[model samples]
Target: MSLSQQRRFPRRRTSVGASRDFVTGVLIEWQLHSLIEDIELCVSELATNALLHGAPPGREFSVGLHRVEELVRLEVRDSGPGQPVVQCPDDDACSGRGLRLVRALADDFGINDHIVGKTVWLVFKAPAAPAPAPAPLTTPGSS
Candidate 1:
């Protein structure tokens, strides 16, 4: 089965934690334990970036999750003006590490630019499904 969900949040500092919690809850419901940690971290980074650089005044950002087969996709949309870029921060810098972390953690990462805003997306390759249990053997005349 496939599942998809999207949620919007105001451009606030709290939205970072809220986005992480939302992703954790959905991953738990979907039984994607293996991906919870990595995905949560990626979501947090993206959400924080959205709140810090992407969201304009009085505008909101959105997060979306889609699971189909052995892959899961995550997205964060913000009403910002510019596309996000990966930066090479100085060793002593305090900021500019979020996109780098996201790129390192996600299997695939990209930005979807629109006329109004942009959507930062990440894709993860889910764990393989477990093997089915073997059938029990029956005697010829057991019935």
Candidate 2:
């Protein structure tokens, strides 16, 4: 198994897009293409929430990626005070949809509170291993 690496960035609304791109790039680096889209979506939404409502402007945030035996965990940490409340929305509600989407996409999701900020985690099953390379074909009429 590959070792896990983590990244931290400032908590700015504009950073949401950048964070998603960063996570996608990391997934490519680790050759985890199957989980790229799901992870990117989750990371983007969670990071957006952290920047928009979870914390104040100019505060810092973090993104951590861990690859275990059969799962990959994505976490977005922010220096915000409040915990994420996942509420089911009515048909007319316009807001409070991010966490719901998180729960839907992630196999398992949760929140963790730190001394200063909080971390939102989303976990998905790791992609199945790529099929082994096929053996070279032999020619019947080889020289």
Candidate 3:
């Protein structure tokens, strides 16, 4: 089965938490409860980056979630210039480590440059689908 959902968020400080909540709700609806924490963390970081660095004035950022079979993909898109970097800042620095943390948590991560902006995406392995139950056995004369 394949599922896809997306939502746009304004360029504001509050959007980071909104983005996390959005993805969490979607995951719960999809029955992927096991991934809520990791996915939520990634969404928060990416949304923060978008709000701070990527979302241009009057332009909105968007979050996309897609699931195909046992694979789930999360994406954050924005219309600002310059690509995001994974930096290993000094230990004392309180910020600039979001991308680095994302890289460590995601099973697969990459960037897609669009004509206007870019999309940062992360992939995760979802739990396998449950097996179907067997039909009840019946005796020769059973109804």
Candidate 4:
């Protein structure tokens, strides 16, 4: 079965934490524990970017998660005009490395622009479920 959810948060510093918590709860509900760490990191980065560069004062940004089969897709939408580009910041730079980190962690990353905003998305392959334990060994004559 596929799962999907979305939430909108105001453009504020706290929204980044809220976004991470929201994503974490959803992944847990969907039994996607294996992806929690990477997903949370990505969500934090994207949400921070949205609050910093995309949403204007009093505006809001959104986060969405969709899981179909073995693929999980995450999207962060904001009222920004330009798409995010990956940049190799200097070793001492404290900022500008979010997208680069995302690119390294996610299987695929891209941006989709709408008439009014843009959505930065990351796609990840979910870890395979463990095999069910073999049925207890049975002897033909055993009860």
CA lDDT scores, all candidates in order = 0.93, 0.83, 0.95, 0.94
lDDT for each residue of candidate 3 in 1-143, tens digit (9 for 90 to 100): 88999999999898998899899999999999999999999999999999889999999999999999999999999999999999989989999999999889999999999999999999999989889999999999889
* Tens-digit lDDT track of model 4 for 1-143: 78899999998899999999999999999899999999999999999999888987879999999998899999999987777889999999989999999989999999999999999999999987788999989999999
Backbone clashes in model 2, listed as residue pairs: none
Q: Where does candidate 1 stray beyond 4 Å?
A: 137-143
Over 1-143, each residue of candidate 1 has an lDDT whose tens digit, in order, gives 78999999998899899999999999998899999999999999999899889999899999999998998999999989998999999999999999999999998999999999999999999998899999998999896
- CA displacement after TM-score superposition, residue 142 of candidate 4 (Å): 3.4
| Model 1 / residue 96 / CA error / Å | 1.0
Question: How do the predictions measure up, each by TM-score?
Answer: 0.93, 0.85, 0.92, 0.93
Count: clashes, candidate 3: 0
> Taking the tens digit of each residue's C-alpha lDDT, what string does model 2 give over 1-59?
75476777686666888888888888898788988888888888888887787767777
Question: Any idea what lDDT model 2 has?
Answer: 0.83
- List the pairs of residues colliding in candidate 4: none
In order, what is each prediction's RMSD in angstroms? 1.6, 2.9, 1.9, 1.3
Shift in Å, residue 79, candidate 3: 0.2
